[model samples]
Target: MDNCLFCKIARGEIPSRKVFEDEDVFAFHDINPARPLHILVIPKRHITSLATIADTDTLVLGRILAVANQLASENGSPDGFRVIINTGRIGQQEVQHLHAHIVGGPEPVGPMLKRV
Candidate 1:
């Protein structure tokens, strides 16, 4: 996992616009944002993807969701937001580490695009 980008971020080896962090999770602004308000929530542990999550990770996953909600409310998008977790190569998951993307605000209106 030494080459994993998110692991580096969670370990504070790389800088991020962090919005929240605790013993179990980390949330931060996405460098390549898809919406006006975009954030990435990730677990401190190195879980490859949702497909690989173990039963013990259930509570940690729940904690990540709760933290995402708190972040959305604090970031001025209390009304609603979208959370996404790309699972594999076909799902467009660039980073091997599991993470959730929180996006909200006016939906972008344009032609269908491959990239978010």
Candidate 2:
């Protein structure tokens, strides 16, 4: 995983505009954002995708969602927001590490929910 970009970010080897972090997860602003408010929430531990998550990682995933909710509320997206997890190459997951894209603020393009 040494070449993994997200792992580098989580390890602080690569600089990122971090919004939140804890022992289990890290949330940072996306370098190439698609929306006004776009952040990527990722687990400190490396997991290729949702399809590869282990049972023990369930709690960590749940925590990621909770953190996303908190961030959205704090960022004035109390009404609603979008959370997306692109699974594989066909899904447009450029990065191998599992992460959630939390996007909101301003006028969102197209439908709020669209399969990646």
Query: How many clashes show up in model 1?
Result: 0
TM-score for each candidate, following the candidate numbering: 0.89, 0.91
**RMSD to native for every prediction?**
3.2, 2.2
Best by TM-score: 2
- Give me the runs in candidate 2 sitting further than 4 Å from their true place: 112-116
Q: Candidate 2, 42: how far from true, in Å? A: 0.2
Per-residue lDDT over 62-116 for candidate 1, one digit per residue giving the tens place of the 0 to 100 score: 9999998999888967888878899998889989999999888655423434776
> Which window of ten consecutive residues has the lowest lDDT sum in model 1?
105-114
User: How large an RMSD does model 2 have?
Assistant: 2.2
Candidate 1 clashing pairs?
none
| Per-residue C-alpha lDDT of model 2 across residues 7-111, encoded as one tens digit per residue | 999999999999999999999999998877789999999999998988899899999999999998787567678999999977899899999999888565458
Per-residue lDDT for 102 in model 1? 86
- Scored by lDDT, the top model is 2
